[model samples]
Target: MERLKQITSLASLAVFRELYNSQTDIYAIISRFLNEIISTNGKYNFTLTEITNLLNDSFGFTIPEAVVSTSLGRLDHITKERDIFSVDKEFERTSNDVSSLKDMSLQKSSDIVDGLINYIEKKKTYV
Candidate 1:
């Protein structure tokens, strides 16, 4: 029983870690994707479907549309007009520091993970 409990706890931790890492990756991908669009075109005009397709193609993994939408919504520069989304023209990246982008992505990922945990806990209490 003790060994099983230990394994279960470790497995849970691993799952949580993967979830956090994946969220971080998602944020980084979306950031870079938007940056590429803005840099190449001087502006960004896209839709959720486009973003979702890009993510899926880049990662070769099926990412849910809701996940993409939620991530985009969290970004300050992204604005929605009906079905289309655009980035603020003035929101250009000022620094080429990869570390800063990673740090920001990690922080955002942590917040997302914490929110998910809190949401689950809240729902558990009601159940």
Candidate 2:
């Protein structure tokens, strides 16, 4: 009984760790998808099934809706605040430093959010 409890606890811990690990890539991809939607359609309302299908079709990987929702929580850009989309200030194909202030985000989402808002303002001029 003691060994069984230990095994179960360890297994659950591993699962949680995987879920909590660096999901930066997933967030970035989702952000890009949301941005494209906003740019073309002007709003986003992708249901869980739709997101699951999109991930499978676009990236060839299937993810649970719960996991995708958790990843989306890390995006930190898209919100109900005027439907603003936080985009990378400078997009570089080879750059992984999407967050402002390089790899370190001290002020957290505020900086990146500002950048995205500014980017949106510039985009408005073209529209």
Candidate 3:
């Protein structure tokens, strides 16, 4: 049963990674990447050139610096200072509550797996 639970968890994680990789929206992709950076580093501070380079290396997408600048301008949660861009802490907290379909699906899958595991455990106790 423990092995089964581990397998299920690994499978769900693989599915989430597949879904994440299949995502195409440049804006969402950039936003998600920025959010990850902020989460890891405690702040997001990168110039257009740096952002473009990182995105290209991370996503294998040859995004132009101009496009990165435009995306930074469009996002309300991002602020510009000279050549650096940073995320708004307040907006970041708010945005965490906003679920895209991808997030919803991943969450639903996790819930279903957890429910199944619980049900199985209950059955074992009865037996």
CA lDDT, every model vs. true structure: 0.59, 0.44, 0.59
Tell me the deviation in Å of residue 24 in model 2: 8.2
Indicate the TM-score of model 2.
0.32
Q: Which structure among the candidates has the greatest TM-score? A: 1
Report the C-alpha lDDT of model 1 over 1-127, residue by residue, as the tens digit.
5433343334334433554576667555555544443444454788888877754543334668887787678678889999998888778655333334434544565666669879999999999
List model 2 lDDT by residue over 63-127, tens digit each.
57666655555554533234232334342323222222211332333355558779999999999
- For model 1 the TM-score comes to 0.45
Q: How many clashes show up per model? A: 0, 0, 0
lDDT of 3: 0.59
Tens digits of per-residue lDDT, candidate 3, 12-121, equal 34533654578766566556544544444455577778767765543334567777777667678788988888877675442331124334645665677779989999
- Kindly give the stretch of ten consecutive residues in candidate 1 with the minimal lDDT sum: 3-12
TM-score of each: 0.45, 0.32, 0.44
lDDT at 110, model 2: 39
